[model samples]
Target chain A: MGRTSDAKERILSAAQALIELRGYSALGVAEICKAAGVPKGSFYYFFNSKEDLALAVIDEHWAGQRGNWQRILGDDDPPLQRLRRLFEATEADQRAGQQSCGTVSGCLFGNLTLEMSNQTEALRERLQQIFEAQVDMVEEVVAAARERGEVTVADTREAARSVVAQLEGQVLFAKLYNNTRRLDALWTNCLALLGAASPGRAQEAPVAPAR
Target chain B: MGRTSDAKERILSAAQALIELRGYSALGVAEICKAAGVPKGSFYYFFNSKEDLALAVIDEHWAGQRGNWQRILGDDDPPLQRLRRLFEATEADQRAGQQSCGTVSGCLFGNLTLEMSNQTEALRERLQQIFEAQVDMVEEVVAAARERGEVTVADTREAARSVVAQLEGQVLFAKLYNNTRRLDALWTNCLALLGAASPGRAQEAPVAPAR
Candidate 1:
């Protein structure tokens, strides 16, 4: 049974990697089957259609992020520290692995929404709901800072949403320009927003009080 | 001669609308040909290839923005006021039209870059040059604020690039959600970045204390 599931896991990972670069429309079943090194007969054994393949890609991507957030947020460090650490980790990860583009750029879910989400309202809602869940992950951290009396926000929920929005946008531009530095700017700005939205997020900056 | 040029204009406009929604790769030449009601031979006459057609669409879009800036930016109002006014105008325009998703969501240049720009350095550079040109336009406004004793920045050029980045990020999220409200949040955050980056810009804020 474990061996049976290994093929499915490999197929999902291969699809995630390909979908990030080529987009959902351009990625064909044949290409995925070839990339996964699975037979065409075996491809149908798991997914119902290309759409099913895409959802699996999104789900697998989501599943990975779940583990990622757990590590970043659960660290022993302070809330602000953990937040910055996550940003740095994201920058490093995006640059090293795959080297195709930003972790968030050309996301299979994003590509699906742009290309065919409207035609598939269920998929659209699912993507939106999933993305919102990611936003909530950030909100949890922001709220923790608030509890610690380390952060203040115009609206914690909105701030978290904005952070994710900026991160998502940064991914698109970074990939568009093929520069990892773009991701860095986004990381900086997100930190700025977190600080500015809070009372004092600039502990590292050494604020000199007005004389 | 005028009639011939208008037909060409109509063809280009139709192609732009379709391409933005579906992306350059998935947008069939035949589909564009059908939507524009231009014969395939006529398309060949106007554009040597689909890439050429895409290039023309980009040229047209840029030309339209130039004209738009002239009308809105050159209004008798001060530049800062004109800037806010233009934002309102853009917001209205998109709501009434295709939701201006310009350079925000699925930008044609951005979309094409992800799909084919990597295949050629010349094409990549062309697209990069175009993005830089867009950034330069926004820089003019930031520069004006600086000169008028109304803006300060650690780096105006960096600030300009970040503004472009923020706008790019926001638009993608906006289109992803199919909600203009999300887009407005991005615009608000962008202006806030401007405010934070330049001491000079803060005084121009609606509620800032007079200098």
Candidate 2:
């Protein structure tokens, strides 16, 4: 039993790394098993198919990410500050990823959404649920900000969606240009999206556009 | 001569549709050729490899999209209104795509960036140029808006990047949810991002947050 569980762990870790490095449709079970250092039979024993393995990877990634999000968003900081922390944390994470991988891997969910969502109903549904949950989490913070009169947006849900969308979009650019600095604009952009006045240094920099 | 050019056009069209419906990696030369109803010989006659074909697709799509963007952004409307028109055109495009294909096939460049940027330098460079051109076009309009005191953004380039990012992000949601309605928020979000006081009826809606 111990050995069997160990093999499963190895496969999951290897699959997740490979999926992040490349993508789902480009991967094969044989390549995943080879990278995992497990035999072909071990793969079938653990996953019914490559899609099954992808679902496991998605769930595992979201579990960790959701925990991080909840901690940051649910903290004791003022609602807007908490949102700032979320953006800061996101940039830090992307920077760290670039350091380790030599290139930003981008949001796994966003990557998969573009690559595999339309190809598989299972992935599409799972990605939809995950994004909805993300929007829900952001909406909670925006709602809190609204109650405190920090934000003037009429629709917290739409505001939250736009914020998340901005994050994904900036991350997409970061990955494309291989630059984490692309993420630096998130906090200011977030504040603007919610119509809240910037608190310090006005977080809203009005420097001349980069020539 | 006409027959040869016709075959190439067919291959390009088929590849773009397939790339939009699925993605680049999951496709094979033979499959694209089969879908084009052209012989595999015709494919190799026009393109060297799948990567080459992808570059052609990217270039071809950009050629047409760039023309549309120039027309809309260069129109005689107020700078902000041109921006508004761009967003509305985008939403209408997505809606038409959803209606025709039963799913919202997102921005082809964005979809490819998330799916292929890290895997290929050639693709990364091409996608970077495409996005930069997009930002340049938007920055022109934004600078015009700034000169008119229509927006308070500090950096027109950064503001433009954020705007493009928002568009990519919203389109991702539109594709993931398979719903074009997700794009309806683009114009409102654009005004917020630019810090421009929305004109007429105040595009800033302080309505109740969606439940």
Predicted structure 1: clash tally: 6
lDDT of 1 by residue, B10-64 (tens): 7798899877766666777788878887777778778888778777887888778
| Residue range A81-164, candidate 2, lDDT tens digits | 999899889889888988988889999999999988878999999999999999999999999998997877788898899899
Instruction: Please give the TM-score that candidate 1 achieves against the real structure.
Output: 0.82
lDDT of 2 at B32: 97
- Where in model 2 is the C-alpha error above 4 Å? A198-211, B198-211
Tell me how far the alpha carbon of residue A10 in candidate 2 is from the true structure, in angstroms, after superposition: 0.8
Q: What is the TM-score of candidate 2?
A: 0.95
Candidates' TM-scores? 0.82, 0.95
How does the DockQ of candidate 2 come out?
Answer: 0.62
Query: Counting only residues 3 or more apart in sequence or on different chains, how many pairs clash (N, Cα, C under 3 Å) in candidate 2?
Result: 1
C-alpha lDDT values of all predictions: 0.63, 0.87
Q: Flag clash pairs in model 2.
A: A206-B154
Candidate number with greatest TM-score: 2
Q: Which 10 consecutive positions of candidate 1 chain B have the poorest summed lDDT?
A: B202-211
